[model samples]
Target: MELKVDVLLTSPQERAYHTAKDIAKLQSLNGTAPMLRNCEGLRSRSLGDWEGRLAAEVRGTPSPPDAEPLGDLMQRGSLGQLLPSCYAAQLLPVPLMVEENAVWNGYYRE
Candidate 1:
């Protein structure tokens, strides 16, 4: 017996991992398991320290030049180097998962 496969065409954005669980349910009804493909890029911009802090606050203080002017540094470093690296990594077939809590838990497990 020859097995025939049906091609299901769907937009990568519309079928992203954000709706993976939902898509899985729908696919199951149609007798197929939903596979999540990581089309979304890395967790690029945390923008943590630079959120509301002003350059004036840390400029004249003991803070380093990079930390004092984080916005500029981020634009130069992250936008220039980091984002390009992330984009390149996204092109690869393998998926990169960032496990934040796991790293911390391993370091400071009580």
Candidate 2:
């Protein structure tokens, strides 16, 4: 598949930079190579006091009664606590499902 991109919003992270470069290459093949830049507003929110901790340790512990609620975060367009989980989802454009008894077929257009 050919993805023609006009612009790409990326973070300062190395992986994000590489991914954007690859996409720009593909776009160049089509015609114009859009500019890729980082935006501070696009950066993910900080975890505050929960930067690094296991799920078990973090759970069952109250958030000091001052932390933002999950629903509130989503309402504010932040996704806050769910950010990590959403990262993987962001890399995936579609869900890939596999079944033992299922057979799939497709055609390669390249």
Candidate 3:
């Protein structure tokens, strides 16, 4: 499906930015590509000292002592947290999500 996207806000990571650029290529406003911006706060969870470590290698490694908690990510789009709590407002995670399309929307009903 095609979407009329005027702007795209992505995390500061290179992969995220690249993905946004790819998506923007498919989006348009009056035949113009969407604008893209990198947001630092929107970055994925920082692995801190755990960067480059394999999950299997550290399955019981206790994680980095300085790593941030996963719950902090919920704050970005949920209750009073640091992630802005506007993920849904931004129409983020957008549409065409397989889990959403095939599982959540496919099974649940009001």
Candidate number with greatest TM-score? 3
Q: Model 1: runs farther than 4 Å from truth?
A: 1-18, 38-44, 50-110
Ranking of candidates on lDDT, top first: 3, 2, 1
| Collision count for each candidate, in order | 0, 0, 2
Per-residue lDDT over 3-109 for candidate 3, one digit per residue giving the tens place of the 0 to 100 score? 55555656667776777777667654348776676545466676778888878877877768678788775465232321133232343332211111121111111
Q: After superposition, how far is residue 13 of candidate 1 from its true place, in Å?
A: 15
Clashing pairs in 3: 76-83, 76-85
- Per-residue lDDT over 1-110 for candidate 1, one digit per residue giving the tens place of the 0 to 100 score: 42111221122343233444454456567676544433223223333555467877656656443343546544533323433443453332222222211110011111
Highest lDDT: give the candidate number: 3
Model 2 misplacement above 4 A: 1-3, 64-110
Off by over 4 Å in 3: 28-30, 77-110
Q: What is the lDDT of residue 108 in candidate 3?
A: 14
Q: Kindly list the per-residue Cα lDDT of model 2 for residues 1-110, writing each as its tens digit.
A: 75444445554456656666776777688788776654332333345566576768788876745455655544433333222232433432221111122211222121
Q: What is the TM-score of each candidate against the true structure?
A: 0.27, 0.48, 0.62
Candidates' C-alpha lDDT: 0.35, 0.46, 0.51
Q: Mark the 10 consecutive residues where model 2 has the least summed lDDT.
A: 95-104
**Candidate 2, residue 11: CA error in Å?**
2.5
